[model samples]
Target: MSIPKTMKALVAYSATEYKYEPDYPTPQCGPDDIIIKTEGCGVCAGDLKCQHGAAMFWGDETQPSWVEPPFIPGHEFVGIIAEIGENVTGYKIGERVAADQIVPCGECRFCKDGHYWMCQPHQIFGFFSGLNGGMAEYVRLPKKAVIHKVPLEMPLNDGLLIEPYACSKHCVDRAKIEVEDIVVISGAGTLGLGMVTYAKLRSPKKLIVLDMMDERLEKAKEFGADLVWNPSKVNVTEEIMKLTDGYGCDVYIEATGHPSSVVQGMQMIRKLGRFVEFSVFGEPTTLDWSIIGDRKELDVLGSHLSPYCYPFVIENIANKTLKTNGIVSKSFAIEDWESAFDAATGKYRDFKVAIKF
Candidate 1:
């Protein structure tokens, strides 16, 4: 394949400003690097929140902005290898692949401790200038970037799901669910649906899902959720208590990113239960600290990006065990990125929206 000198991409100029260039210079790969011609790139909620001026992304009075301008803005992408550097041994040109979103500084203390996901000077691809993301026709995978070959049999849209699915696996791992445990997943969105798919593999006592969308809740039932709830139709907490016989759920995974869901999770989780928070909230959420400490004695776990779970995710996708049916609601061309972004931002209530090259 002939590599082009320039390609189309979306570059960030500010929290709310993005430049859609039709012919931006393509990224160059180093000796140990590789390049992929994007097949699909899913627009995540974080991208939308960052663009809408979320303080955590834009930085406010007391914090520094995490996302700098002039960087591409799509992390959940899958592509075919267009170029491979001289020393890149495992990959070949024309292979399908997905790159881990975060590129850690190998010398950092966390990386040295085998927790690369916690590296202090994290340079996430697509957000930082040094590691540009896949919201383009082509993306460069640097030496430090973790790359995994995606099986060709998987649909491109399904393959683009690796990143978020991997994160869901991490969240499930954090919960440490037991076969006898009652698990409740809040939010039947993509991440929550991903959780339901994998959580069922553990064979928990009961798998309950909550969402306001009846359609998503129905999908959850099909994905192996033992029970599904619509907060709009019933008092979720009250119904949960009835289902659990007033004991409350043993494991509560919060993926709604809604402030009320946080409070609801705190109230519905049993004493000494595990509460795994996996959502990237659009704004600060305030809740009573007493429930976490003195009141319930619950174990609160915060889940970040997918770490050490990529291989498992890859295997699931290859095996068709991750439930990709109807997951990708829409795919748009690079020129229609604005519509794609809007659809992905929940303007259309789609499961996932991606840009296809």
Candidate 2:
């Protein structure tokens, strides 16, 4: 097969914030690199946060790769290899795979110690200093970071959800949510809903989801949440405590990043219980230390992009343990990115947003 001289893509230009246009040239790859013709890409909330210059997108503009004005926005996508670079091993043209959006340099002390996820100089596919993402038609994958033999195909239009499921796997593992333990997930948005679905894998004593939107609340119950607690109507913390026999919850997963929810999260944790701050809050929020004072012993933890959760999520999806057919409400073509972005902002209980090419 002959390598095409140019391919179509979406590019971001400098000036204002990153904006998408109809077509940009597909990137070329060198040794140890591969290019994938995108099949689908998931619109991440972080992308929206990055666009408006939130804390989510860090690094200096002077250092370069600082959104670079006109860069593509997408870290989550699945596709087949379109081109392979010289010396790239273990991957064949036309193979189905998911490339690691972020690859930590192996030389880092943290990486050499088996904590590769924390590699000091991390290489990310979609966002960050260098390299392109999947929001466009083609993505370049470094040789060492390509994930193969993973299930990236779904009946035509559904494959875009694989990445979100990968995130769920990590949350479930880090949350340490035990079966028969009362778990309260304080957001029914995409990430919250994914966490809720993952929380149900174990037959917990009770699973409650808190969100302002009744539509999302309903979707939460549909996705296996034992109950829906709307802070708008009921006292969320008190209701959760009441459900746990008034002692409080064994686990609290805050996915909203909303300050009010964060404050409520500090209050919802039981004495000696675990509180996982998993939300991608766009702005800063204040939490009172007194919430964890005296009586309550809390394990406050944070989970960034799930690094060790790919295979598990893939297996579960293969075994029918994870259901994509349920929470996936809509998919938009990358051309309609404006609507796609709008849909990501807690609109109508969409557990996940998929973009098809």
Candidate 3:
């Protein structure tokens, strides 16, 4: 395989500015690094939110910006190894692979403590200029990066979905679901559906999904959700309470970026129930804090980026234990990124959207 001197890439210059550069310099593999020839990369909800200057990415009066511009914006990617450094072991050229979204600085306290996902610098691919993402013809993996070999037989869309599924796995793990507990997962988007699949593996007494879109709700059922609800057509709080014999659900996982879903999870979870908050909200959510401590005494947990979950996601995706069909509903060439972005942002009724390189 021949590596290109220049490649097509989506470059983010600012919060609202992104350009598709047809001649961006292809990353070079250092003695301790490897280069991947990108096959496909998924468009994440955070990408869409960052594009519109969401406070979380752009920062606000109370918080600092998490994103550094002049970088490529995609983290869910899969590719073939085009070049391998002399020092890199256990990987060879032409192998299919995917890497964790975050590249931790090994010297950080968090990294030293085995919590590299929360490294102080927190440089996630696609958001840091030094760590370009896979929205290009090739991507470079630093020696410290966590990389996993993807099965060549895995479908392209399933390969691209590895990152999101890893995230969903972590979120579900945070819930600590029991076999006899009733589980309620909010939102039926890509992440939520992935949660449904993994949560079902626990064989909860009942797994319920909530979403405004009937299309998404239908897919939830196909992914092993026992019951699906459209919040628009039904009172989800009352329905969940009724299903739980007025006790409320034992576990509630919030995957919807909407504020209402946060409120709904709080209102429908029983006392001492575990609540896992996983979504990257576009705006601040105002809720009654008293409900968490005074009324329910719920166990509130936060789920962040995928940590030590890539290998599991890759193996399960290859084995078909994790369902991937109908999740990646649309794809576009890198040249048509604007249309892809629109489709990913709900302009079309899509479960997930990807940019093919």
Query: For each candidate, what is the lDDT?
Result: 0.89, 0.72, 0.92
Instruction: Name the runs in model 3 displaced over 4 angstroms.
Output: none
True-vs-predicted CA distance for residue 240, candidate 1, Å: 1.7
Better of 2 and 3 by lDDT: 3
| Per-residue C-alpha lDDT of model 2 across residues 1-357, encoded as one tens digit per residue | 454555555555532345555546667787878888887787788776775566335445444344443467688888888788889777788887775556777888987897776677666666642577888877777756737455544453335556776676676667798875888888877667777777898777888899898988888888888889889999988887777777888888888878898788777778888888876765679866866766686888787766867766666666767655556677887778778777876565566677787
Candidate 3 has an lDDT of 0.92
| Over 4 Å off, model 2 | 1-3, 21-23, 55-70, 156-158
Model 1, 1-357: lDDT tens digits are: 888999999888887688799999998878988988988899888888777778887799999888877789989999999998999897788898898888888998999999999888888888877778889999998888888888888878788789989989999999999999999999988888888999999999999999989999999999999999898888989988988899899999999999999999988988999999998876689999999999999999999999998899999877988887888899998788888888987757899898888
Question: Pick by lDDT: which candidate is best?
Answer: 3
In TM-score terms, candidate 1 sits at 0.97
Model 2 alpha-carbon miss at residue 9, Å = 2.5
Q: Is candidate 1 or candidate 2 better by lDDT?
A: 1
TM-score for all predictions?
Answer: 0.97, 0.90, 0.97
